[model samples]
Target: MTTTAVDPAKCRRCHRALTSAKSIATGYGPGCAAKIRGAAKTADLTDFKPAQIAKATELIEQGGILRTRRPNLYTAVSGDGNTTYLVARQACTCPAGIKNRACYHRAALTILAAA
Candidate 1:
């Protein structure tokens, strides 16, 4: 009989070694998987207008996005020294976000987090 060697598994999100059977099967660590799922849910719920999507895509292509230590939170800095915090569930600190409107920061965060 021929023997097969099993390769070690790693999380798809964090690239960490997945020693647990469940994690190996899912391809993501428990924490990472949970975060990804939550982000995906948020992303699905977000509605991005055409302008917002264009702006978000430009920001992402320009590498102007920054992920914060807090989960589901991100800081986006513009070339003009303007900074906006995209808080999950909570509204962003930008003017548009403060007015209860979807901002480019939120759209950018949704795109990045979903990825």
Candidate 2:
């Protein structure tokens, strides 16, 4: 009689022990999964909203516009320090800020505008 069993040392990618729990491609035990999940909380996406990310991306891509509500805001940059651009609320001047929705500058701008 033959019994089927999973090899612990086999890695789906390199056929070795998947040391990095981030390798979701190759599944490990539940404990490993849980550990990875805990490590990647923001990426878990249990309540992920694609629309929100899309909207943020759009806002960033559109860039910021100077408005009467918030003065002294910066949008785009130039070699000259005098060349200041007013950024619209929640707008980011970075690609990652637009696509990945991870712009610290945008966040800072928003906070400053709010305050």
Candidate 3:
């Protein structure tokens, strides 16, 4: 019988090769995983509206938020999935955020970080 080649594990966020068993099992490198835990600890959701938080949770469940190469930066998909906006801790490129209003993209980021 021929042997099948096994693929090596990689980080989920950065796609970097994982050498440690813990990293492989977690599907994220130590650094990338730390970003989520660290951000979650410092996140403040008090200012966001309940509706916004609910929508953010929905967005995340639908896999609408994606982590970028840079830490604390992510791409958030629009409601219709036609466009993507850059989201950071303090800002987002969405229409509401462009006008300095609260946007669900940022809320999604917080929710994702906590997860």
User: Which of candidates 1 and 3 reaches a greater TM-score?
Assistant: 3
Please tell me which model should have the higher TM-score, number 1 or number 2. Answer: 1
lDDT of 2 by residue, 1-115 (tens): 9999875543321334655554433333345434433433333233324543344223322332223444554554322334444444445445544564544344433433332
Cα lDDT tens digits, model 3, 1-115, are 9999989987766789999988876766888777755644456777788788778766755557878889888898999999999999789999998998889889877756564
Question: Against the true structure, candidate 3 has what lDDT?
Answer: 0.78
lDDT of 1 by residue, 5-78 (tens): 88778665577889987787666688876775555445653477867877775665454666678876677765
Question: Runs in model 3 with CA error above 4 Å?
Answer: 1-43
- Count of clashing residue pairs in every prediction: 0, 4, 0
Q: Highest lDDT: which candidate?
A: 3
> Distance (Å) between predicted and true CA of 54, model 3?
0.6
Q: Which of the predicted structures, 1 or 3, would earn the higher lDDT when compared with the native?
A: 3
Clash count, candidate 3: 0
Query: What ranking emerges by lDDT with the best candidate at the front?
Result: 3, 1, 2
**lDDT (C-alpha) at residue 48 in model 1:** 71
Which 10 residues in a row give candidate 3 its minimum summed lDDT? 34-43
Q: Whose TM-score is greatest here?
A: 3
Give the runs in model 2 whose Cα sits over 4 Å from its true position: 1-73, 76-86
Cα error, residue 42 of model 1, in Å, equals: 14
